[model samples]
Each structure stands twice: as C-alpha cells, then as structure tokens.
Target: MTHIAVLGSTNMDLVAFVEKAPQRGETVTGREFRTIPGGKGANQAVAAARAGATVSMIGAVGNDSFGARLRSTLEHSGVETDHLRTTEGSSGTAHIVVDDHGGNAIVVIPGANGTVDHLVPGDEGLIATADALLLQLEIPLAAVLAGAQAARAHGVRTILTPAPAQPLLPELLAATDLLLPNEHEAAALTGRTDPRSAALALLERVPQVVVTLGAEGSLYATRDAEPVTVPAPRVTALDTTGAGDTFAGTLAVAITEGRPMPEALAWAAAAASLSVQRAGASESMPYRPEIEARYTS
Candidate 1:
C-alpha cells in the first residue's frame, strides 16, 4: 500500500441542516444537527485511508472529550495516530451550516489546532517514511510550512490544500510539490476567476497545480506539460462538505500508486462525487472498492 502522512488539524464538526442558510444577523430554524469528526487534516487522513493508503496523522487534539473521540475516529478509520498529540484545553471545532442545495458555510475555531505551531519529536521521521504528505491550512501556517519543508528534505511528494485561502509564503510554495485548490481558492490566490487561468498562474510558483471545479471535475497543470481536465461523475449532491478534501486525499493515493494523471484525477473525482451524495465530512468518504466502482461506472 502507498504510505501517506498527513499534517493538519482535528476538529469536531458541529453541523446544522436547514432549508437555507441564515443571512447575516438573521435567525433561521434548522431541520437537524449532528456533531461529526472532521478538520481538513483529519478528513484527508480518513479519505486516504479509506482509499487503501497506509496513512499516518501528525497533529494535535485537545484534552477534551472531542479530542478523545477525534483520535478514536482516526484509529477506527485505519489511520495511524502515533504522532497525534493530546494537548490542554478544547479540541478544534468547525461550525457548519448546510443548506438544501448541498452548499455549505463554515466557521473554524482553531482551539488546540492553533497550538501545533511546530512539529514535535518523530514528526520528521514519520514524514520521511511516507510516499506522500498531505497538508492543509487549517493548522498554524508555521506547522504547515515546517511539514512541507520536512517532506521536501526527504524527497517525499507534498500535496497542499490551500483552503480558507490566505497569502502564502514563497518558502512554502517552494517546498510544495502539488498545490491543490478549489475554484474559489484558486481565484483568490491568483486573481484569476477562471479555473484554467488560475491554475496556469499557480504553475509559475508551484511546478504542478490541480484546480477543482465542482461538478465539472478538476484541472491539472504542470510547468512542462499540457493541462488535463477530468470530468466528475454525474450525481446529485446531498451535503457538499468535505468533497474537496476527498478529492485531494484520493488523488494522492492514486498518484502514489502510479496511476497516470488523468486516471488519478478521475478516480479522485469519483470519490468526491460519492462524498457529496452523503452528509458530514469524514463519515461521507467512500472506500477503495466504492471509488473503483464509481470510477469504472
């Protein structure tokens, strides 16, 4: 199996399902509510594991009930959590609202996630053993940069998801092997509303980029090759939460397994399609067999 390392955050997702999301300063009734285990890092870890990768998670959870559940959830999903630390105070949490259209809005509280500013003992070694390292912006930028740098030093491929987009440092870009961003995030990073334009612009900094277009699929670009566009499997979405992470994590597994870029992107898109058809984050990711079935259909 391809070994993947994840450096990111762990959060309990507090999700509210409603007919429509409330507007600013507005009160609206929700149909249902559920607390799900998530966080960009944890979601990716679970996605990759379910996709048949031997995944290890490196991050921190709080000394609260959510923290214990978070770690248990990862372990249950077959992710090794030897490097996942338990710190003081509350675990991270994402306050999420899902509308009937399958669209979502989220607010993240860093909590214990904010404390992971740097790698603790054994993090570098764990990263060094991986075929690929998955990263996201949910944790401290310092930790993200450090993880990327460590992966670079070990010649391990680093896949970064720049969600909740922010200005990135040159050093972090230099260390990243693949920069995966959704349409909105790509536009934010490159000032190009077009996904293709944004991906091309991103190639100037990172050698490779994948810009995800919801429903339409994903675009892959590299410094020295023609871009590839992979279409998503047509399906109705139930809750679009965690779809992007599903794509990123599954893509890493496909790539590490030596699938061609086009095939890899399509496989990842299949996983994302399955995720959106279900509710919650980590709970929604499909397993390897399900992904294969969807991709082949």
Candidate 2:
C-alpha cells in the first residue's frame, strides 16, 4: 500500500442544522445539533486510509475531552497517530452551521492547533519515508512550510490543500508538488473567478494544480500538459463539509498507486460524490470498495 503522511489540524466539529443561516443578531430555530470528529488533517487521513492507503498524521490536539475523542476516532479509522501531540490548552473546535440546502458556514477556533508551529523530533524521518505528504492550512503556516520543505527534500510528493484560504508565501507554493484548491479557494489564491484562469495563475507558482469546481467537477493543469476537465459524478448531496478533503485524499492514493492523471481524477470525483451523499466529515468518506463499486456501477 502507498504511505501517506498528513500534517494539519484536528478539531471536533460542532454542527447545527438549520433551515437557513441566521442573519446578524437574528435567532433562528435549528433542527438538530451534533458533534463529529473532524479537522482537515484527520478527515484527509481517514479518507486516505479508507481508500486503501497506509496513513499517518502529524498534528496537535488539546488535553481535553474533544482531543481524546478525536485521537480515538483517528485510531479507529486506521490512521497512525504516533506524532499526534497533545497540548495543555483546549482542543480546536469548528463551529459549523449547515442549512437545508447542504451549504455550510464555519468558524474555527484554533486552540491547540495554533501551537503546532514546529515539527517534533523524528517527524523528518517519517516525511522521508512517505510516498506522499498531505497538508492543509488549518494549522500554523510555519508547520505546514516545515513539512512541505521536508517532503521536498526527500523527493516525496507534497500535496497542499489551501483551505480556510489565506495569503500564502511564494516559497510554500514553490515547494508544493500538487496544489489542490476548491473554486472559492482558487479564487482567493489568484483573485480570478474563472477556475481555468485561477488554475493557470497558480501554475506560475507550482508545476501542477487542480481547481475543484464543486458540482461541475475539477480542472487540472500541468506545466507541459494541456488542462483538462473531469466532471463530477452527480449525486444528491446531504452534506458537503468533507467533500474536498475526500477528493484530495483519494487523489493522493490514486496518484501514488501510479494511475494516470485522468483516471485518478475520475476515481477521486467518484469518492467525493459518495461522500457528499452522507453527513459528517470523516464519517462521510467511503471505503475503497464502496468507491470502486460506485465508479463501476
């Protein structure tokens, strides 16, 4: 199996289902509330593991109940958490509001996630061994850069998902092997609304880029190859919280397994389509067999 190392955040997602998001200072009745083990790091690790990759995580949780649950959840999903640290402060939490249409607005309190600014001892060795290193921006930028640099040094492919989009340094973009950004994130990164133009703009920074266009599918660009579009599998979405993470994780595994880019992208899109039909973050990712079945069905 291909090995994947993920360096990012771990948060417990506190979700509330409402008919519509509340306006400023206007209280609206919600239908339900639930807590799910999430965080972009944990979600991608779980998704890759379920998609048949040997996965490991490098991140920080808190010395709180949410941290404990999050750790257990990752362990249960078959992610190696030996590098998962526990800080003295509160665990990270993502306060999310999901409306009836499956759209969501989220506010994240960094908490312990803010403390992961440096890599722990032995983390460099792990990065060297992995076939691919997955990363997100939920954690501190310094740590993400450290991991990306280490992966680049070892000739490991570094896949970066710039989520919760922020202005990134050119050095970070240069170290990335594959830059995965959703439509909104792509726009945020390039200040371009068209996905293709955004992807082209990003290619100036990284050799490869994939712009995910929610339901329309994904667009891919490489230095020499012409850009191509891969249409998403149509599915009635129940929730879209982890769909991008699912796509990223699945893409990593498929690429590591040596599948062609177009085939790998189709496989990833199928997995994400399945994920959106379900509800939670990590809980929504489908297993390899499920994805294979769906793709062939």
Candidate 3:
C-alpha cells in the first residue's frame, strides 16, 4: 500500500449555493445549502485514501457534533485517524459560497484546528512511516513547518499545497519536495501573473513545483527538466471546490506508486476532472478504479 501522511486542519464545511455570491453589504438568497466534511488536510486525506493509498491524517477536531462527524467521514473514506486528535470546544468551520459558474469564495473560522499550532505525540512517527507527507496552509504555519521538517529528515517526499496563499518562510520551501499551487496562489506568491514565470520562480526554492490551471490542466516544473503542461479532461463542472486537493492527493498516491511525474499528473488531472463534475470536496473524489479508467481512456 502507498502510505501517505497528511498533517493539517479538519473542518466542517458550511456551504451555500447561490446564482451569484453576495457583494459587500448585499444579501443574496442561496439556492441550496449543505454541511460537508472538509478541511484542506482532511479533504486531501480522503482523496488519497479513495485513490488507493493507505492514508493517515494528523490534525485536530473538536469534541462537538461536527467534529464527530468529521472523524467518521474520514473513516468512511478509508483514512486512518489514529493521529487525529479531539480537542475541547467547537470544531473548525468553513463558510463557503458557491456560484452557478462553479467558482467559490470561503471564510474559514479556525476553532480546534487553530489549537494545532504544534505537533502532538505520535505525529512525527506517523509522518516518518509514510512514503509521502502532504501539507496545506489551512493549519498553523508552525505545525506545517514541523511536518515538512520531519518529512525532510526522514527522506519522505513532502508535497506542500500553498492554499489560501500566504508568504512562505524560506525554511518551509527548502523542505518541500513539490510545491502545489493554483494559478492565483502562484501569482500571489511570485508577484507574476503568468503560470510559467511563477512556477519557474518557485523552482528556485523547491526541487519541483506543480501549478494547477483548472480547465487548462496543470504545469509541472523541476530542476532536472523543462516544465511540462498536461491538459485536463474537459467536463462540465458543478463545483470547483476541492479540485486542487483532489489533484494533489491523487498525484501523491501516483508518485508513491512509482509512476513517472508526467503520467502521475495525467492521473491526477483525471481525478480532478471527475471531482469537478460532482459537488462538495471529499464527497466528489473518485476512487482509484475510476481514476485509472479516466487516465487510460
């Protein structure tokens, strides 16, 4: 089994679907609502687990109802939660608004997730046992750095997703094996609006970088070779949320299984294409069999 450890946040997603998102001081009626299990960390864990990896989640949830459901959801998706801690108080929540065009805006209220500012007992051991350590910026920077540092020390591949883009520390980039960022995040990080320029700039710090371009697929850059662009399979998207997480998770699984980077990117893109055709983050992830079929076909 491909063992992947995900160290990050866990939150309950409170989603509202509207024809269009509301503007400042404007209230718009939503067409639908849902409470979904998600956090960048939890979602990636689910995506990896469903994509045939033995995935473990190292994060914190609260002792509230949402927390319980979140843990169960991870378990249901075949993610190992032995390192998932339960803290006192409300769980983290992501207030999301999805527009008809499949775009979304979100506000995350960190509750128990905020408590994970440092690694707890068993965190390093769990991370050490994995073939890859997956990370995201949804949690505290210290904990994310700790996980990356541990992964680097153990020779485990570290894939860092720079979501909710923020300025990154040099130490964090130095430890990251692969940096995954969406187009917007890439632009924000490098102050360059173009993906090619942004990715090449990131490669100066990290060994490899993958800039996700939604329908345009993804771009892969590495120090050893020229950048490669892989096109995503075309599909009507119902919800674009979690597509990057899905891609990152499936790509990690594929890489752990010894697939070449190009093929892995194709597989991840297929998985992401499948995800956008559905709604919700973790709920939309396709299993390994489905991803394989999409990749081959």
Candidate 4:
C-alpha cells in the first residue's frame, strides 16, 4: 500500500442542515444539527485510509471530549495517530451550515490547532517514511512550511490543499510538489477567475497543479505535460462538505500508485462524487471497493 502522511488540523464539525443559510445579521431555523469528526487533515487521513493507503496523521488535539472523539474517529478509519498530541485546551471546530442545494458555508475556530506551529520530535521521521505528505492551511503556516521542507529534504512528494484560502508564501510553494485547490481557492490564490488560467498562474511557482471543478471534475497541469481534464461521475449531491478533501486524498493515492494523470483524476473525481451524495465529512468518504466500482461504471 502507498504510505501517506498528513500534517494538518483535527476538528469536530458542528453542522446545521437548513433550507437556506442565514444571512448576515439574520436568524434562520435549521432542520437538523449534528457533530461530525473533520478538519482538512483528519478528513484526508480518513479518505486515504478508506481508499486503501497506509495513512498516518501528525497534529494536535485538545484535552476535551471533542479531542478524544477526533482521535478515535481517525483510528476507526484505519489512520495511525501516533503523532497526534493531546494538549490542554479545546479542540478545533468548524461551524458549518448546509443548505438544501447541497452548498455549504463554514467558519473555523483554530482552537488547539493554533498550537501546532512547529514539528514535534518524531514528525520529520514519520514524514520521511511516507510516499507522499498531505498538507492544508487549516494549521499554522509555520508547521505547514516546516512539513513541506522536511518532505522536500526526504525526496517525498508533497501535496498541498490551499483550503480556507490565504496568501501563500513562495518558500512553501517552492517545496510543494503538487498544488491542489478548488475553483474558488484557485481564484483566491491567483486572482484569475478562470480555473485554467489560475492553474497556469500557480505553475509559475509549483511544478504541478490540480484545480477541482466539483461536478464538472478536475483539471491537472504540469510544466512538462499538456493539461488533462477529467469529468466527474454524475450524481445528485446531498452534502458537499469534504468533497475536495476526498478528491485530494484519493488523487494522492492514485498518483503514488503510478496511475496516469487522467486515470488518477477520474478515480479521485469518482470518490468526490460518492462523498457529495452522502451527509457528513469523514462519514461520507467511500472505501476502495466503492471508488473502483464508481470509476469503472
């Protein structure tokens, strides 16, 4: 199995299902509410494990009930959590509102995640042993940069998801092997409204780029190769949360296993399609068998 290491945040997702999300300074009633385990790092870790990768998670959780649950959730999904530290505070949390249209709006409170600004003793060793290291912006930029540099030193491929979009440091991009961003994130990063143009702009810094287009599928670009676009399997979405993470994690596994770019993007799109048809974050990701079936269909 391809071994993947994830350096990111672990959050308890508090989700509210409603007909429509509340507007600024306006209150609205929700149909239902539930707490789910998530965070970009934890979601990718679960997605990779379910897709048959040997996954390890490196991050911190708080000394709270949510922290315990977050760790348990990752372990239950087959992710090794030896480097997940329990600190003395509240775990990170994402407050999400999902509408009937399957669209979502989220607010993330860093909480204990803010404490992971640097690597602990064993983090570098764990990253060095992996075929790929997954990163996201949910954690502090310091740790994200450190992890990327460590992966670069070990010659391990680094896949970064610039989610909850922010300005990226050139040094971090220099160390990243693949930049995975959604259409919105691509726009935020490159100031280009067009996905293709945004991706091309990113290539000036990173060697490769994959900008996911939700139901339309994903686009892949590399300096040495022609860009590839893969269409997603058509499906009615129930909740779109975690769909991008599903794509990133599955794509990382597919690439690490030597699948062609087109094939890998299609496979990852299939996983994302399956995820949107379900309800929660980590709970919505598909296993390897389900992804294979969807891909072949």
Candidate 4 residue pairs that clash: none
C-alpha TM-scores of all predictions: 0.99, 0.99, 0.99, 0.99
lDDT of 3 at 255: 96
lDDT of 2 by residue, 1-297 (tens): 999999999999999989999989999999999999999999999999999999999999999999999999999999999999998989999999988888999999998999999898989999999999999999989999999999999999999999989999888988999999998999999999999999999999999999999899899999998899999888888899999999999999999999999889999999999999988899999999999998788
Report the number of the highest-lDDT candidate: 1
lDDT to native, each model: 0.96, 0.94, 0.94, 0.96
- Clash number by candidate, in order: 0, 0, 0, 0
CA RMSD of each candidate after superposition: 0.6, 0.7, 0.7, 0.6
Order of models, best lDDT first: 1, 4, 3, 2
lDDT of 2: 0.94
10 residues in a row with least lDDT, candidate 3: 117-126
List candidate 3 segments past 4 Å from native.
Answer: none
What's model 3's lDDT at 161? 96
